[model samples]
Target: MSPAGAQPIRAKSRHHRLQEHVLETTTSASLLSTSYLATSPIAQQILARDLAECSDDDEDEVKFDSEDDGDDNDDSEEDFSTTLHGGAAAHLISRPSGTIYGTLRPIIASQVQGSPAVNERDLAQSRREERSLLRDNHILPPKHRRPFRESALRQLYRRIFSTKVHESGCDSDVGKALESSPLLQHDYLSEDASGPPSPSPSETDVLWDCATVASSNILKTTWQREAKTLAQYSGPLILTFLLHYSVQITSIFTVGRIGRKELGAVSLAAMTSNVTCYCVIQGLSTCLDTLAAQAFGSGHKKLVGLQLQRLTYMLWLLLIPIATLWWFAGRILANIIPDQDTAALAGLYLRVLILGTPGVAAFESGKRFVQAQGLFHATTYVLIIGATLNVLANWFFVFKLEFGFLGAACAVVFTQNLLPFLLFLYVRFIDGMECWNGLTRKAFTNWGQMIRLALPGMIMVLAQYFAFEVLTLAASRFGSADLAAQSILVTCTSTTFNIPFPLSIAASTRVANLIGAKLTDAARTSAKVALFAGCLVGLFNMTLLSSLRFQLPYLFTRDDEVAAIVSRVLPICAAMQLCDSAAAISHGLLRGIGRQRIGSYTNLCSYYLVALPISFATGWVLGWKLEGLWFGVTIGLCV
Candidate 1:
């Protein structure tokens, strides 16, 4: 018999007769457990042919056993209840690939010496008897519906093995088995055996988990199982971040072209005005990223949309303080800066950028909301459109209209504000929005419960990004030439750093989704896949940037000294890219698992308590110039 479940035929005439008889009996059987109509007249012949082959194999096995060893061949009677053991494969799924099922025979499992040599006839008979007994008794087959649970199926397999061993021809087989009950107990009994005395539940669970993981998709290649999940989210995630960060970079470039003063003001505004607002609101919205993903996975469809609505409201209120802070940014900067012009312009630009504060909060919150629902491509599409138009708006307002710094800030406001509206429209109209209900007062509630997660997530994002900007501040003391070079390098590395941003989002969403769906094995597999993918992407970025270190500086600056400094520092940044990517993805994994606070606490200690001190000490005390600052930063990233 072939392992694909086709047994060799011993008698062609009897096989034909048995096939017709089994088909007649199966056709007349009623659907029991599941709902379905009778099979069509056209499919009856094909069904009969498959069932007939199954019965032929069964009868042959019965006859072969009867002839070879003298056990009850059990041939003539048709007991339909026999199929319950393994016959559902024939009556259930109709596969186009022509794969057969329920053809499993009792495997000859005994290894004891002195046992009779099993011949082809015995193997054939064993397989045939299992199949025939499954289909023969006229005890009404189950309907085409839900399959058996893993525990029950595992028990069935155990029974099949036990039965096959006992059926062998050796007289001492039972005695040999009973003498080794300890070994049998190890395999069959749970560790914490109950009052009835059985195997431990832990051992049973382990067996079932292995079996369940093994049985997912028969057609999916073993190598493809883990990778397929990574593929689903990684590509869209990369594209989304690419489009997203482009909007910010374009804003920087458009205003940078205006003048050095305008550039400085916008940079300060980003640090002071936008960063706080953007990071805080976005971080808080990740509360939904974790919650909504689990909710969707757990089958609470409405909860996902409601969570989205709730986050939108929460962020709407969260942005009020952020906007007010930006309003006073210029005044705040004036106290610290020796140059009043730079400080006042910084304040003015922030107020302008604040024009889009609600937009940033809304869009970022909406992004997390839809992303949790696995609607990644929608975010990508909106970002692409917003990014394209943002460049044009920046060019038109800053260069064409001579709006100066305000022109750059206005473009940011318009682009960011538009994203949330566009994403909202998509959810309302698209297929995945089955969870979205119109807004309500319920969204305004859930303050304390949601804040528990939101607070840690907000701190995690702020601590990491804020630590990075500190490196920039530390570079400023090295003189204007070093500062400009550091700025270009930071921009380049930031863009390069975005390669892993998607992976983080994907990891976060995928992990939560799997956990909510009650698939812990799949969730663990996803984490492993995400980690491996992060490594690959990090290595690729490190190699690419390192190779382009000399030439890439020209893309960012025309100044020889600035470009030269960038070229020198580029390698350090490249090496750190790998670590940075891993850190980012790790952050996402933590968020996905609803453990953002651990990462938050870690970053606080690593960046402030460790990394910053190292940078300050190395850059100033050791006088290693810009390299010292980054080296210190890299050391912190390692931690």
Candidate 2:
């Protein structure tokens, strides 16, 4: 009070000390006491001055908070500083405080000087920054994110749909969605929690992808499958006809060497056996082949084996009746062939051939199963084997053993019957598959399905074979030379049509399986390829037949009269080859589509209603003779 000019050094010193204390205190402690420290530093000084000014006019005494535990180290420091400035030497040292004192001291100081308010604001700012960082890092809330993810998926589906990728499979839109978002993986590896990613595609998958060209390219381009199909089927068709030609030439040759009686018996026996057996064998084989194709395509190997077993039982049972009838074929032949002497000759051939019925039936079953695997080349090999055996056996029995017509029938029996057994054993052991698992009671129960598939084609085959046989019988009445010439021409026509038959079969199997397996693109491509293959085969055979017209007569006859007659009627035969080739291929295509009934009906209408009547009329009433009958066949074929 005496040092008037010194002017409030005490207040200034207090302010300076307060700032230094605050700077040293932790912001964590300040925040804990933020509620109690709402005033600014300068405002607290004004409040203290006001309290001092009010001391003179106070009626009541000021209350001191004696409860303050006397633990104010900061306040003591201020007092000691004040005393030093007043020319007194005083020193104070602080003792270490207890836990409560340490905790509360900073809190109390923060409240007195508004340090808590600054700390509270900093803490709030820190909380906001944390939230912003999380948002920036893609840790979005469930409600705000799910719809966005779903929208992205929907857009992806739309893009695939627009690109025509959905045409690749059945319910393709769904498949595409599943492919993108694999549900099966969800159970094993949760997408929500972080984990390692999926590995790269496998070698097989990569190869398949690389090989899979666009559907457009597959449709336009011809593949080796088609070329192989042409080679495989065309050869068999030609061979079937060639075999028929061999029968006719053998008849004429035998007649020239032996007599008409012996030749007639052999020719009738060959025709009766080949036509009847060929229909049953091919029909059943087609059904079996189609089944195998479906099973293979769908990856149902076990089911295929089971179905094959069923077919085996059904085939064996069916053969029982056929075999029994053929066993008594010697007696039946007396009425079928033209003369009693020819009947005796034909009966001997039939008796020997009938011995091979079981073998032939089994062989056909095995062949169908193999061919169904799209191994069209198998047909060529099997045919070659049979042909070789037949040729060798014929030479041995006829020329060496002097077995006559019985020798030829024995050759047919030995070769045809043995082939299927060898093929079955090879396919089962070497190829490691059971194409013929044999008959069981379980197979019989499933035979209804097999019969459902087999019957239409079987009936169609029977009708066609019967019509051809009747036409041959009628032509035989025109004279032996006319019969021989007609046989050669018919054989040529039949062989050419056979080439496209397998192509049709492959198409049916592939398309049906692809459709069943939900591979729409593959199915469509298979159908187109088959159709193209059919057309190409027809065109090629037509070209071949046209070029070979002059040489056709030399194959079957040395007689100038027969050659001249064949040359006169060759145009109709050529036309029949063209028409029949297309028809046979188309018929096969229809069968592949499981539309065998439609093909059967088409055959019925083409052959019976049209071909037969015209053939009879031209041969019998019109007096056009063999040319007229062939012309009727040509017109009937067009119909």
Candidate 3:
């Protein structure tokens, strides 16, 4: 064969390879546009540019082969091929007479022949044209054209739940899909490598947005899978929350048996301790959800221990003031309460509780530390032992030893202190020791970040807790019968809350994990399942409370008046269960989306602005008493 004859055959082979490459690229772009590119301006621009380049090449091929073809029929076939392969590109190419592809193709080709500087200039020009095309097409919004300034919180979340961790796992179908997706890999790598220009911050945002959207659509998660995950998480969590709650309720059961005064006093003391101390401890330790979990997830194992220590120290220091308040609480209660005897007994219970404050602090912080390392069962184990001990101690001290109301307080104090010790033994002897560094001086330093996160959490918790405690205080104004009945209502509602609250936490965990994995649709699906589960739990609680309304009060108190008042108000409390569960689960959903501030604001406004005023008006002003107070609470939960 002559050299001229050889040229056409090589050209034909090159044409076939280019055609195949163009076909694949076109298919990929179509799939991407359908699933992901809709959210990504930068990706859309790149695909458009590639199509335009292919169109230009086809036009050049047509021009070159036009003279060789004898018939008009061959020219028409070439035109149809051009339109079929790059219809959008043909339209785009025709609109821009001086398209970047027309000018840069020669330079890009020449760069393979070693003209580096001209190729660099041509590449820069190509980028500018891409941006212009993006803007003209209205693909990139003007506001988003500027550098995307990520919020500090979002940046921190990304850093904590980085793609490196997900890539390492590749556990789920979604993870495997992400790992296997060459289109996504190419888009991500192109920005990092020297071949393509790095994307601007806005473009970077668009790229990730595309990936997330595409992954969510392509890898659809089933409702059954989400429900199973929720069940796994919530089952143990429900038991743990219930057992932990039972520690206080045990004291109520023992103390309530003595008399109506003791029952009201126990309720008053429990409310006071919870609002002033336990809620603060829980809230401050909430920082560990982010801090300790981030540290553990990022593989800084010892930082988890340091966080725990710092939070524990903060709590112990805060305890000094809390203990003082409890010691003098009797005098404070005496001035406020209509019944001096009940106030004195309540204050005595608070004073006894002061001994257990440090233990509560340690346990709360330690619980988070272990949970951050995925050691959820450790707390459950400790609570099982602690709750059982509390029950037996309550029975022995109050009944066997005949120590009266103070014995229930003693039993509570013993259990509260014992819990941290039990948790410590588990951590030291069991699974979570890897994250525990020995007590260090570093724990005392760098308190600012922890405190900053803690204060807002504390305030949010206080808002919710204080709202309920205020209802307890308001019921006191109605006298011992109403207050004791209020205690039963609060206990029943709180016990039922344990079911849905834990379910919500489970749902939140599932949702947050899905969001981190960029499974947006899956996260949304999980949230819906959680809400549905919450509704079911709420219905169960409602049925139980309403059906056993008369009998349920006798379990707490033998007093005829208290039981009568409780029976009258029990149905109202049962009616609030659905609303209560929905509210708790909704808050969990908000937390999952990193929009907990919205939940906090809503809680504050609904409880304070909506619920309390109505309670005050109906309970006191309209003489509806306990029933009206709960009606207000029900209204608040609805909001």
> What is the C-alpha local distance difference test score of each model?
0.55, 0.47, 0.63
What C-alpha lDDT, on a 0 to 100 scale, does residue 391 get in candidate 2? 66
Q: Candidate 2 overall Cα lDDT vs. reference? A: 0.47
The TM-scores, one per candidate, come to 0.60, 0.55, 0.66
Question: What's the lDDT for candidate 1?
Answer: 0.55
Q: Candidate 2 — which pairs collide?
A: 233-499, 234-499, 237-495, 237-498, 363-420, 508-592
Tell me how many residue pairs clash in candidate 1: 17
Candidate 3: tens digits of C-alpha lDDT, residues 483-568: 88888888888888888776766666566545544556657878898999989989999999999999999999999999999999
lDDT (tens digit, per residue) of candidate 2 on 81-153:
2221231110110000000000100100000111111222333433332222212222211112334345777
Of 1 and 3, the candidate ranking higher by TM-score: 3
Clash totals for all candidate models = 17, 6, 0
What lDDT score is found at residue 619 in candidate 2? 79
Candidate with the greatest lDDT versus the true structure: 3
RMSD to truth, every model: 22.0, 38.8, 23.3
Please write out the lDDT profile of model 1 over residues 465-543, one tens digit for every residue. 6766666555645655565566566667777766776566667655654443234555676788788888888899999
Model 3: CA > 4 A from native: 1-216
Q: Give the Cα-based TM-score of candidate 3 against the true structure.
A: 0.66
**Top model number, TM-score:** 3
Score residue 489 of candidate 1 by CA lDDT: 68
